[model samples]
Target: MKKLYILGIMSVVCVFFGSCNDEWKEELHSQMISFKAPVGSNGVCDIYMRYQPDGTASYELPVIVSGTRDNGRNINVKIGVDNDTLYHLNTEKFAVGRKDLWYRQLPENFYTFPSEVCQIPAGENVQNYTLNFNLKGLDLNEKWVLPLNVEEDPSYVRNIRKGWCKALLGINLYNDYSGTYSTTLMNIYVDGTTNDPAIVDNRVTRVVDNNSIFFYAGSVWEEDENRSKYKVIVTFNEGELNKDGNMAGSLTIKQGDPTSGANIVPVGDCTYELIVQKHETKPYLERHITILRLEYKYTDFTSDPKNPIIYDVKGSMTMERQINTLIPDQDQAIQW
Candidate 1:
């Protein structure tokens, strides 16, 4: 009786090992093709691109094959622009009925796909779809999106999982002086008085061109529907380095819409200084610091169009951008 019990246990072990043998030999999950783009709460993947003048910048979007085992055959994944998806996404995201706030589709003139089809050879699990961008005249005021989709093919299985087959790429172009500036030292006061001041900690400046950027004037920000009226465009003109190893420059400040916008006037000579320093401990780290000395005045019409108030903004603003020399990619090198 004991011998029979031992025989029965051996038989059960053999069956269990035999069943798992076939499982490990082949993939149990479906080999579905999908995109590697990850979206945020806004349903868009924010990608940073370094501004390239008179040239094209390239971004590689990864196409992945899902499964435990290697891909058995080659895949020619057809890619196309899906504007309809972007239109529906905008409507779903922003139901506030504000068209200006909606994301705009990137025009064809700004971007081009090297190949409409991405080829993944046998035994490869991933490949990149290259998108070349010529963002020379790209407007930064409007939010831009590049929507891509993987077309369904009879040759391979497509990943039907949510957000796997589609990618919403939000393009953010950055230049040398276009970024967030620390505005704690900057003070805003009513046109006549300078005692009590209103200070904003941080102010974001948008890129206008290779050497120009625009920011909201004084305490005015994006919350107001007519915030565009207070737009202050600043163009940097860099000069030779001074004795202190600092490059001095002057800024040309202008109203975005001179005719129909807030009456903006410069109080003094608006100038800037740039300083570059290397990290003491980390030799691979480099820091670029920009200091802006500004004194400007602008009329605020959005607070109450009927009763507009004039504000006097003065003092210095600073921005520091750190670059890692170890990274090969320009976009990834910035600590932003």
Candidate 2:
């Protein structure tokens, strides 16, 4: 009786396996084409590009054929600018009345799509589409987003889930000198009154070039209606080695927009000192400390455009950059 029971169990297992053999050979998932770009909380993929001297940069966008098996046939994926989606995103994120704060579509002159169609060759699972950028005169004041879409085609099945077919690339550029600096020591006061001063904890600097950066004048943040007019450009000169073996240099400060009502002038000798030191415990880490001693005076025109208010700013701003010695890529090496 026990032998007969064992034989019955073996026959049942054989029948189940034989009946499911054909199903196992069938494909379980569809072969769909999609982009590998991942979006952040803001619904845009933030891609960092190292600022170039000539104001040129390129980003390779990845296009992938998703499945358990390799692509069986060649695919020419159609691509285009999805302006409607970007418009909707801006509307959803920012109030319609706050147009100035809305993310702007990257102008056509700023970037060029190398090809409208990305080719995924047979047997390959992915391919990169090159996007060339010319940011020579891009106005960094406005938030820029490059919106892209994967057009539907009979050659391939397009993935519609998880933003696979669409990509909103938030273009961000950084240089050696461009970043947020601690402004705890910096103080702002009314043109003549110095007793009661206002201090901001931090300020962000925008990249002008490899050695130059710009920031809004004291107390005037980016949200100011006429903030661009109060731009303060700081250019670092070639450094001379100090007694401590650290590099120190004079800073050239200038107003960005001359036509504005703000009468900007340097109050004293502007300079900067850079100190480099190795991490205490981590051998593969290095720290760069940049101390900028600034003294300037500028008028805030936007608060009351008709009657501008003059403000005097003084003291130093410090920025620290950490570099990972093991990372080969300069852009990825720096802890941004």
Tell me, by lDDT, which candidate is best: 2
Per-residue lDDT over 1-336 for candidate 1, one digit per residue giving the tens place of the 0 to 100 score: 999999999999999999999779988899998898899887898888876676468898999999999998989999988878888888887757677778899999999888889999999999988999998877677789999988999988889699699989998888888889999999999999969899999888887778888888998765556767778898898677888989997898888887854889888799999999998898999999999999999998767789989999999999999999999887889997
- Per-candidate RMSD vs. true structure? 2.4, 2.6
Model 1 weakest 10-residue run by lDDT: 221-230
lDDT of 2 by residue, 1-336 (tens): 999999999999999999798676765689898888898887889888998888899988899998877788888999999888888888898865878877899999999988889998999998999999999988887889999999988877889997789989998888767788999899899889978899998998988888888898898876776678888989999989999999998999988887877788888799999998999999899999999998999888778778878899999999999999999988668875
lDDT of each: 0.87, 0.88
Give the residue spans of candidate 2 off by over 4 A.
14-27, 70-72, 280-282
Steric clash pairs (candidate 2): none
lDDT of 2 at 305: 75
